[model samples]
Target: MRVAIIHDELMRRGGAEQVVLTMLKAFPDADIYTIAYNSEGTYPEYKEYKEKINTSSFQIFSKSIKLMQKFYFPWGIIAMKAVKVTDYDIVIISNTHCAKYVNIDSKALVFIYTYTPFRLAWNPSSYSQYNNAKGVFKWIFDKVISCLKYIDFKAALRGDYFLAMTEETAQRIKDAYKVDDIKIIQPDVKTRNFYVSKQPGDYYLVVSRLEHYKKVDLAIEAFNELGLKLIVVGNGTKAAELKAMAKNNIEFKSGLSSKELADLYANCKAFVFPQHEDYGITPLEANASGRPVIAYGKGGVLETMIPYDVHESKCTAVFFNDQTAESLINAVKTAEHLIFDPAFIRKHAELFDENVFIKQFKSFVEEKYEEHSSSVIKSH
Candidate 1:
């Protein structure tokens, strides 16, 4: 079958972008459709996909447009809708943002792997950019945000089927769109890249964008108070602010190769994840490395990490309920007292491996395609 994948702009490599790459592997022949593409800005490996990538006229202004994402998002939706995907038999939208707004023919089978309803639309509190606006800027923000919410809702109604990334996201979609019958398709983690280390390192590790909603600040604050060695491995808008707040115990590094990341995951005393994600893949990556996680016990982490308790000898992670430094510190202190079985944690991670994802996602899409084809035949 002719297949095409639509994704939000590809300017950076993150969990959402990783999911798009996995989808490409699932349907290797599928062409990728997006509003813009920046080869050097994202993963260097994406350079190979340059031939299969189809972008809108918006790509011509990629540089300036990306810097103004807040203003360009609606334009992106417009550009995506203008691009036709009717030629493809199957259109799979890997959307954390606006790709679901793509226009497809009625005959084409379109399935969306929804991470969440747009955060700026449905859950603006989680978006730092919007939450930080002030005075006149806040007024403009509200006006644009309100308009986007309306447009986003109308666009969401166009999907033939929705495949949620987790139960948490599924619930959000149901609430936001009032749509039922959503399939849950979790993203895959490459477990083989990581392995258990015989001797764990002294420092704790956090590998996430230094964004406000990611709550990297909480991790930094907790570690600072505890005077524990912490290594933060990612760069983002809040990098300078986070660095200024950090003590000598906190170390920051960026542009680590895959091998370097894998080694850090393998040897870290514990992995820290303070954000509420739709389906947090980092925790599973940590588990794959046979290292326990110290995460906020909310959102997708609940589904991924096996929370530590007295009864579970082979627990994988411990969670702090509140999004605060005090809470995370307490959780960390508690986690230090628990016994984590490296083999058990790695085994648990194996359940969500790349192979499992490919098999399940391929099967789900094929089944939907067949069913939709059968319905078309009956209608005729």
Candidate 2:
């Protein structure tokens, strides 16, 4: 089948982009369609696939999409609808927000891999920067946000099937779109890239986008109070704010090669994850490196991480119930007390390896395609 992979944007190299990459491996000949793309802005490996990518006119603003997304959504829907993908037999939309609205052939099966129903639409309060506007400014902001949400909801209805990244995200999809049929498929990590380390160094590691919701500031605060060595990697809008708040013990690093990041993961005392993600892969990556994690006790980490307990020798992580510096500090103490086996931790992470994901995702898609084709034959 001629397949086309559609996505909202390609501004950064993150979990969603990782999903796109895995999909490309599954359907090697599939053409990629998206609102915007910057070859250098994401993983360098993606540059090799440049010939197969097609971007909308929005590519011109790819660099600043983070700032212009509010405006991008309303116009992006119109732009995507006009850009045809009718020639393809399968059109898979990898979306968080607006790419679900892309117009395709009525007979084509459109599968959507939803990261989470547009977070700004479903849970605006999570974003402190958006909520900080007061009086008339806040009023206008809420008004526009609400209108965009309405459009996003309508866009969601266009998908022939919805695939959620986790059970947590499936609930979000059900709550937001009122859609009952949803499939959960967690993303995967390259297990071969990481391995068990016999000796660990004196530091904690966190590799994440410095976004407000990620709560990197909390990790910085916790590490500061403990006076521990914490290495914070990745960059985003909140990078400057987080840097200013961090103590001398907390070091920020950005743009590390995969091998370099694997080395850091292998040597770190423990991985630190402060965000409540839709489905986090970093913790799994750390586990693959045989390092335990200190994470916020909620969200997708619950699915991937086995919480550390004094009695549980096989636990791979310690959880903090609250999103606070004190909570994380306590969790770190708990991690320090536990006995984690490097080989056992690596074995746990093997369940979510890239090979497993590629197999399951391909089977799901093929099954759906066969069902759709049989039904169409009967309709005649």
Best by TM-score: 2
Which residue pairs does candidate 2 place in steric collision? none
Query: What is the C-alpha lDDT profile of model 1 across 126-204, one tens digit per residue?
Result: 7777778899988988888798788888878878889988888999999988899999878989887888999998989
The whole-model C-alpha lDDT of candidate 1 against the native structure comes to 0.86
At residue 70, candidate 1 shows an lDDT of 48
What does candidate 2's lDDT look like per residue over 1-380, in tens digits? 89999987888889889888899888889998888888778877778789988887766677775754655656766676666777888888998876776778786888989998887788888888677989988997798789868988987887888999888899999999989999888899889989777899999999998888989999999998999899999998899999998989999999888889999999999999998988898999999999998999899998998887564568888889999999999988877766778888899999999888999889999899999999989999
What are the lDDT scores of the predictions, listed in order? 0.86, 0.86
Off by over 4 Å in 1: 61-70
User: TM-score per candidate, in order?
Assistant: 0.96, 0.96
In model 1, where is the ten-residue run with the lowest total lDDT? 64-73
Number of residue pairs clashing in candidate 2, backbone atoms closer than 3 angstroms, sequence gap of 3 or more or interchain: 0
Q: Cα lDDT of model 2 overall?
A: 0.86
Model 2 segments beyond 4 Å from truth?
65-77
